[model samples]
Target: MGQAMAGAYLDRGYAVTLWNRTASRADALVAHGAVLAPSAAAALEAGELVVLSLTDYAAVYAVLEPAAGALKGRTIVNLSSDTPEKTRAGAEWFAGHGAVQLTGGVTVSPAGVGQEESVILYSGPRAVFDRHRAALDVLAGVADHRGEDPGLAALLYQINMGIFWTAMLSYWQAIALAEANGLSATDILPFATDTSDSLAGFFTFYAGRIDAGDHTGDVDRLAMGAASVDHVLHTMADAGVDTTLPATVAALFERGMAAGYGADSFSRVMELIRAS
Candidate 1:
């Protein structure tokens, strides 16, 4: 990701200074007009706006700790993946060194960097963001500033990851079911794609009600969903496919039903979730 990001800057005629724990990892970017900094401090000193694209907060600290002195009066854009709480702590840590911290949650893979459709979620002081907006745009065409809170970007990213991983696992579950029934994944691909695409309408319809704290079952009831999930669980079981994911869904629906939300919309589970 670091290499891709640096390459993006270089492609746009920006002078990029590259550094990595394994210095050899940046050979390609170094060849393509990026200066190979000798150390993390050298890299920090090379640019006023430093971008940290490391593994996590731990790695970020390890790399930046030695360069804290050089960080004074600079801006640090941390694109590393970490929890919201850790991101908030990191912002405080940077502030102690007189450096401003900007949290960035990249929404695309390294290969997608610099693509027109790629997006990155950012959160920090609006003034600082505006100052570097043009340079940040070189990394992705769509850069959304979520809010002033440094953790907002990480929070949003985790929420997205939660949905994405579950939805992807559900697709895998469906594929396994198909394979067990003598239907190849190729045969079920179109249907799976259609089913995923159809959820957009459900989201749009429920967004207003969800925001209004209205989990009325006028559209769909938890009882109905529980029954449907039961059928899915059984179908997967009968097909000799793994039932772990479906069983987890079934448990949640059953819990909602038991919590007196049987006649309420499945969104009512949100309340139970919040209480927990």
Candidate 2:
């Protein structure tokens, strides 16, 4: 990701500096007219806006702790993945060093860096963001400034990632179920894609209902959803396939039903989740 970002900057005619724990890892960028910084401090000192695409907060802290002094009066854009609390703490850490910090979450893979279709979510002091907005746009065409709270970007990232991973898992489960019934994944591909594509409409419908706290059962009842989930579990079980995922879904739906939401919309499960 770092290499991708550096390449993007270089392409934009910016004087890019490269640094990595493994010196050889930066050879390509160095060959591409990016200066190879001798150390983290050298990299920090090389640019006023320091972009960090590290593994996590632990790595961020480990890399910057020794060069804390070099961060004074600089700006740190941390695109590391970690808990919101840790990201927020990192913002504070940079502040303590007299450096401005922006917590960022890139919504695309490294391959998508610098692409006009890609987005990068950011949260920090609005003034700091506005100051470097153009440069950040070099990394991704769409730079979404989420809020003043540094944790907001990370929060949004985690929420989307949670949905992404589980949705993929659900697709895999569907493929497995199809295979158990003598259908190849290729046979189900188009239908699976169509089903996933249809979710956008459901999201639009559910968002308004959820925000209004109106979990009306008129459209889709929790009881109906729970029963459907049970059927899914039974089907998986009867096929001699893994039932763990569907069983878990059924359990959650049952919990909502047991919570007196059987007559409410499936969205009523949020109430159970909140109470838990």
Candidate 3:
């Protein structure tokens, strides 16, 4: 991602300084007129706006802590992944070093960088973001400033990843089941895509009701949902495929039923999740 971001900037005619724990990683960029900084401090001193695409907060500290002396007067755009609390703490750490930290969450992969549809969520002082908005937009077409709180970007990123991984794993489970039934993933592609696409409508329809705490069964009852989930579990079991995913889902619906929400909308399961 760092390489991609730097490449985007270079393509836009911006001078880029490259640095990495492994110096060889910067070779390509260095060949493209980008200066190779000898150390983290040199890199920090090379640019006023320092974009970091590290593994996490710990890696950020590992790289920056020793180079703390050079951080003053720099704006650190941290695109590392970590918990919201850790992100906030990182902002404070940078502030203590006389540097400003702008937290960011890239919603797209390296290949998507610089694409118009690509998004990067940012959170920090709005003034600072505005000051560097153009340069940041070069890395991602949609530089979404989430809020003043430095943690908001990280929080939203984590939420997005949670949903992404869960949905992807569910799709994988379906693929496994299909294969067990002598079907190829290609055969199920259309149906799976349709099911996945339909989730947008479900989310839109349920958002208002969920926010209002209205779990009336007018749309779908927990009892019916539970039965449906059971069928999925049993089907996976009969196919001799892994039932872990469906089993966990069925358990959640069962909990909703046990909580006396059997007559309520299946969306009431949100309550059980929240309580957990």
Candidate 4:
């Protein structure tokens, strides 16, 4: 991702100074008119605005700590993934070194960087963000400034990832079930895609009701949903496919049923999840 971001900037005619633990990893960028900094400190000192695309906050400290002296007047944009708490702590750490930290959450893969559809969430001091907005826009089509809180970007990123992983896993489970029934994944592609696409409508319909704490079951009932899940579980079991995913889902629905939400909307299961 670091390489991609740097490449994006270099393509835009920005003077980029590249540095990595393995210096050879930046050979291509170096050939493209980007200066290859000899050390992390040199990279930090190269400009007032420093963009970091490390693995996590741990790696951020590992690289920056030894180069602390160069950070005093720099604004560090840390796009690494980590917990919100760690992000907040990192902001404080940067402040202690007389540097400003702008937290970022890149929503697209490296290949998507610099694309018009790509998004990057940011959070930090409003003034700092406004100052660098033009430069940041080079990295993504949507440089979404989430809020003044430095951790908001990380929080939203983690929440997005939570949905991403679970939704992808559900797709995988569907593919497995289809394969067990002698159907290729290609055969189920349209149906799976249609079902996945329909979720946005459901989410839109349920958001207001959920926010209002109204699980009236007018649209759907927990009892019916649970029964449907039961059929899915049994079908997978009969197909000789692993049932772990559906089993876990069925168990959750069963718990909701046992908790007397059987007559309510399945959305009421949110209560059970919250208590858990």
- Name the Cα RMSD for model 1: 1.3
Clashes of each: 0, 0, 0, 0
- Model 3 stretches with alpha carbons more than 4 Å out: none
Error of 2 at 142 (Å): 0.9
TM-score for predicted model 3 compared with the true structure: 0.98
User: Which stretch of 10 consecutive residues in model 2 shows the poorest summed lDDT?
Assistant: 267-276
Q: Which regions of candidate 2 fall more than 4 Å away from where they truly are?
A: none
* Candidate 1 overall lDDT versus native: 0.93
- In the range 1-276, model 4's lDDT, one tens digit per residue, is 999999999999999997999999999999999999999999988999999999999999998899998899899999999999999999999999999999999999999999999999999998999999999999999999989999999999999999999999998999899898889999999998899899999999999999999999887999999999999999999999899999999999999999999989999999988745
For model 3, the local distance difference test gives 0.95
- Candidate 4 achieves a global lDDT of 0.95
The sequence of per-residue lDDT tens digits that candidate 2 reaches over residues 1-276 is 988999999999999986899999899898889999899999999979999999999999899899898999999999999999999989999999999889899999999999999999999999999999899999998999989999999999999899999999999999999999999999999999999999999999999999999999999999999889988999999999998899889999989988899999999999877845
Q: Candidate 2 — what's its lDDT?
A: 0.93
Model 3 residue pairs with clashes: none
- Kindly indicate the candidate among 1 and 4 with the higher lDDT: 4
Global Cα RMSD, each model: 1.3, 1.3, 1.0, 1.1
| Residue pairs in collision within model 1 | none
Native-structure RMSD, model 3: 1.0
Return the number of clashes found in candidate 3: 0
